[model samples]
Target chain A: MTATQLSPGRVRKTPAGAAAPGRRRAFDRYLNPVLGAVGVAVVLASWQICASTGVVDPKFSSSPSGAFGALVDSFKSGDVWSPLGSTLSIVAWGMVISIVAAIPLGLLIGRNRVLYALTDPLISIMYSVPYVVFLPMLIFWFGIGADARVVIVVWSALFPLLINVIAGARNLEQSHLQVSRVFCASRLMTLRSVAFPATLPYILAGVRQAVGRALIGAIVAELFMGSAGLGYVVQLKTSNFQTDDAMAAIAVIAVIAVLLNHGVAYLEQRLTFWSRTD
Target chain B: MNDPRRKLVVDDLRIGHWSRRSGTFALACDGLTFDVAENAFVAIVGPSGCGKTTFLTALAGLIPVESGRLELNGEQISGPSRDRSLVFQQASLFPWRNVVANIEFGLKAQGRLDAEGRARVAELVELVGLSGKEDKYPRELSGGMSQRVNLARALATDPDLLLLDEPFSALDAQTRELMQEELTRVWQADSAGSGKTAVFVTHDVPEAVFLADRVIVLSSGPAHLVEVVEVNLPRPRGPEVKRSPEFQEISDYILSLVMSQNKPGRRTEDHDSNAALSR
Candidate 1:
């Protein structure tokens, strides 16, 4: 009764027992970016000094300035788009296919005893073995093309995601399950309402892992096969001894990796916001 | 059992299951029979491994009735139905959902969260004293608060029969007492005029006496009906009612009944209680 009462023109908005986050959030927001910039600046400064002082051959290891210059030049020349687009497209397609295929399959395998038993060994083996070992067979089957690259990405990304979803579906709380049943929710309703929301934290985690692996798979595929991607760009530049261009492409790939991770992390924050704080 | 006005009838009910893991037959309830009048608040109490929770689950249709009649409104209870709802022991709110969304789950599950249903949910939220906290998540709420949401969620559907499974047992002593008072208030507020029939299963004798018009006591494991004590306590009761002589007398009688069923003196009730809770 005391907790419920509010004076006129007043409100109680903060969650019980949680401190106000406004001041702390602002400090963290600025502090992290400042700290990250300092770390990156230190590394770049060290690299700049070594290159300028001729401590190592710039021919073999490009300086931060050289890479930065090449990056601008490549963007101006417009050749960066082709490889970046190709690699990104492959990752995008692979993720779409994997998500479409994995969620339902994992749920079915998890919910059904016979299916889980039948697939457990096969899935474990598939997840355990590196997809790098499958490159030769994949090329043999699908050839060194965009389709092959997408297939490899799916191969690498699907299992971690599938496994997480299976766990989420299988580890349902007995009380939650009972609540759903007592409400007489149909099977579909149970899945959509109870199971899906409950599984969200695990699913988001799986997506974070899957997206990281998918990017890695796409790059590796392009590197091994003489393909049209940032990986191939890095390969071609290195073979030509254009170390600056290769470093620039590497820099672009690094930015892409960081951006992809942040994108998924932001999604996790939005979707599974209730997970860790509790 | 054959009363026309009886809202619920559990006649010679036997609930048993074949456990594949143990390769044995586990009998929970044995030839139990009882009747609940329409809109009456009935509570069940027993010793630690007694089948009271199993009986409540059977009434909720989460567990199957092995034999005899377990009927609501004269229809045989088979599986879960929309006419009934259960307030689980744990709060069991989806951590992802805010309090309002969790309360709306029952209506939403049954495809009845229309404008009217939404209004009813809002009403229950207020009734349960969660007015300003509708958007709060389960983790943010205290034990007592979460159970309020649980109770509100069950009531949101306007179930004909509400089954509660030791909803306040997990709370601390003070919070549990406060919640008991809150529950009675919410029950009356939501029911408004003619109340809904409710069956509360608990190990706490005081809680059984405080909440129910009738308290049905069961024996130990393989539990059956032992006695049904009618509590003629005045309605609109408060926490102070627990200190009254009449309340203490009823609670003490039920407590002794429960204690007599225990095999050993203070035999690890906390540890083995989980079995009875989930039965």
Candidate 2:
């Protein structure tokens, strides 16, 4: 064979195939961030124009500048950080609890047909019943504290994570499992080497969706019962007719959701780099 | 051509399975017996759905032998072990693993190799002519290259008996021919002093004739060995041997047996005679 035939890299570098390494690198460095910034600017400009021109009442549809002004005032008032911190802490703890509890349950249910069948009805019922309706009962039990908010967040996050993980684990190819058997891999080794890695992308996607749901759950719980958090602040402002402050809190929640989704996506990309190339 | 010095023996092997969807026992093989001698390359050929896969699986102990005995080196085969290695038709390399990692799978399972396993993996990769593609994933490989990796992975364990189930069936004709040559080179290298035994399954007549010390033709399902034709052609055999009259005669004889079995009630046709000679 010639040197060109022996070298796999040269074959990949050929035109009309995948992009050259140098070109891909350049695109990564120069184009992605610029395009992202332009996208954000355009959305903000449209929002600002609509609000400032009174396409809707400024009282209801707060401009980008109006929301920023409210954010600055809230910061000056010295109470902003505590509520934001509280909200973040609840979200973080709730996510940890959800992951710890849901993944094992999902794997168990995924692998065993009997367990899955037994739990199917209960999970469907839990998923169908909006936890918002159970807020009063939760307050009666946990008494409107951070614990209660966390409980609500867990309720919201658990089912999607459970369902996706179960599906992922169950969907593992029989051929891969046969390979494991042929090699006589120990049960633990098979789970670690084959089961876990294969199901990681699906689990990561579930976590992404769960993070958004958890935020909504936490905020909703706080809105109904608590005197602190971004949701509480929104409730307080809206009740007092401070529409700009309420909209600002809502905007912050949107930004938080976007950031969490993107963060999970980045983690998924890193964990499943092999999958992407394939 | 029954060999007196047999390295592996399967006696009265019967393999059948009850189809879960159809709820009927589908008989794949019935009353099959064969013997492969030490350092021998034995090829089994049959048409599609002729229980070729089932027979190979039975020998590898992947499927349970319903009522038969499979002896390897005079020991009754029980289950999959390090002593016997199989190369499947599809490469079936773990997509998550790279080439080197895949080759080390059996060793890792046996817990015989340590961190120094990379050295042995490098040797096999070189043997398969995949030296620099060690870090490449299976999906990155072409069909031929992936099959090469599969062959390397099976050989890495250094098994006494190698069982290949139509291992090169997926490659194109040209690539398949090249791979057959590569396989012969590898087999000869292994057989030099070690006396490695191989059982290769294929449907291609020329492939069986080129690669085997003996070619065993199986009848259609319920399949059993119809003939075991000894190929006394000399090696290192080249592409030119395929054109020799001796090669043609043996090829024609095996093809006649296979064709005759396919149409048991009818007189053998001129098409069968011409087709067998043409290849």
Query: How well does chain A score by TM in each candidate?
Result: 0.89, 0.82
Question: Tens digits of per-residue lDDT for model 1 on B1-279?
Answer: 446468898898998766555667777789898899988999999887676777777788877888999999889999889998999988888887899999999999899999999999888888888999999988789989999999999998888899998999999999998888888887787744446789999988999999999999988867788898999999989888988999999988888888888876433243333443344
Predicted structure with the largest DockQ when compared to the true one: 1
Residue B277, model 1: Cα distance from true site in angstroms: 6.8
Chain A of model 1 scored by TM-score: 0.89
Local distance difference test values of all predictions, in order:
0.84, 0.78
lDDT of 2 by residue, A1-278 (tens): 00111101111122343555887766756686899999999998998998888887878777789888998887889767888888888999999999999887887787789998999889878877886888888889999888888998998988878877777778776666656666667777787787777777667877887898899998998799877899998999988878889887887788888899879877876676556542
List model 1 lDDT by residue over A171-223, tens digit each: 77767777888887889988888777777766767877899999999999999
Assess candidate 2 and give its lDDT: 0.78
